[model samples]
Target chain A: SQQGEEDPQALSIQEGENATMNCSYKTSINNLQWYRQNSGRGLVHLILIRSNEREKHSGRLRVTLDTSKKSSSLLITASRAADTASYFCATVKGDSSYKLIFGSGTRLLVRP
Target chain B: DTAVSQTPKYLVTQMGNDKSIKCEQNLGHDTMYWYKQDSKKFLKIMFSYNNKELIINETVPNRFSPKSPDKAHLNLHINSLELGDSAVYFCASSQDSQPQHFGDGTRLSIL
Candidate 1:
């Protein structure tokens, strides 16, 4: 099983600015996913970038995956106060079962 | 309507007691998972079920058991709970190649 570890356990940023969080995994992965969890709430899926894909974008969310480095980055452009949450990176291996192994997480505080 | 929902958002139990958390997903998804969020807010997968078939079972203790009566419902039962069992438990569901949808979560406190 592959696990992802995020950098900068916590982050504080101003609204309207872009926030970048990086995640590095141990082994090869079939896909990498990003999830956001608000205070005292369950995690909500944000985006997913496959191993073969180098980059993916969804509105203000951008995910880049580098297979060689076994790392991935998630960027939120023009972040808003609503974006304040703990972001986690999850990896899914190539096995038939696509179970996810989650990372510690990056707590992003968007100070408005 | 919420896609995924868990019962008793908050559970307070004493040690050596048995408790269960119920989860249901109206999204008609075939896969459901149970995750444990520790004090540090680290989410870890405990178990997963696909259409009532056990798929992923992590290194969780034997005292914790997951029961999937059907594809839409997966319930967790803990026997002789300990202090270490206290944490936020989340239930999630997903379709093939789709993102996961999580329930609000159940905050279990064992005293």
Candidate 2:
């Protein structure tokens, strides 16, 4: 099993500015996923980046995975107030094959 | 229709009591999972069931049991709950290689 740990536990930014969060895992992963959760709500899957891919994008969200660093970063472009949420990175180990481990998450607050 | 639904969005109970949270997924996924989010917002996997069979148990106490009557339903039952058991419990389901779809979660407040 792999453990994903997110940095910058809390981040505050203006609506137009970009918001970036990073995650690092302990072991090799088959895939890494990012998720978002609004206040007191369940998690919503955002994006998944496979180990072989270096970057992936969906609409305003972009994710980059660096296998050498064992790290991944998620960037939200032109963030809006509605984008305020807790973001988490989860990793599925290449060996474990079944379970996905979640990180402690980074809380982002986008100012209107 | 909601893909995944969890009943009793909020649960308030006393210590030493037994409680259960029900979850159902209409997506026809093969795997269902239970995750606990603590005050720090740390989500930890407690249990996972695949096609009505227990597949993943993550060192959680035996007092916390997950029962899957069928592939679509996975219920969590806690016996003799303690104050530390207070947290938000999320139910999720997914098929192989698919992202997990989560329910709104059941907030358990132990008094």
Best by DockQ: 2
For model 2, the superposed segments whose C-alpha errors exceed 4 Å read none
lDDT of 2 at A42: 82
Q: How does residue B56 of candidate 1 score in lDDT?
A: 88
Query: Which runs of model 1 end up more than 4 angstroms from their true locations?
Result: none
Which stretch of 10 consecutive residues in model 1 chain A shows the poorest summed lDDT? A92-101
Residue B97 error for model 1, in Å? 4.1
Q: Give the lDDT of residue A70 in candidate 1.
A: 93
The backbone clash count of each candidate, in order, is 0, 0
The Cα local distance difference test for each model comes to: 0.92, 0.93
For B18-96, candidate 1 gives per-residue lDDT tens digits of 9999999999999999999999988888999988999889999999999999999999999999999999999999986
Residue pairs clashing in model 2 are: none
Question: Which one is best on TM-score?
Answer: 2
Error of 2 at B88 (Å): 0.5
lDDT string for model 2 (B40-92, tens) is 88899899998899989998999999999999999999999999999999999
Q: Give the Å error, residue B41, model 1.
A: 1.1
DockQ for model 2?
0.77
lDDT of 2 at A5: 85
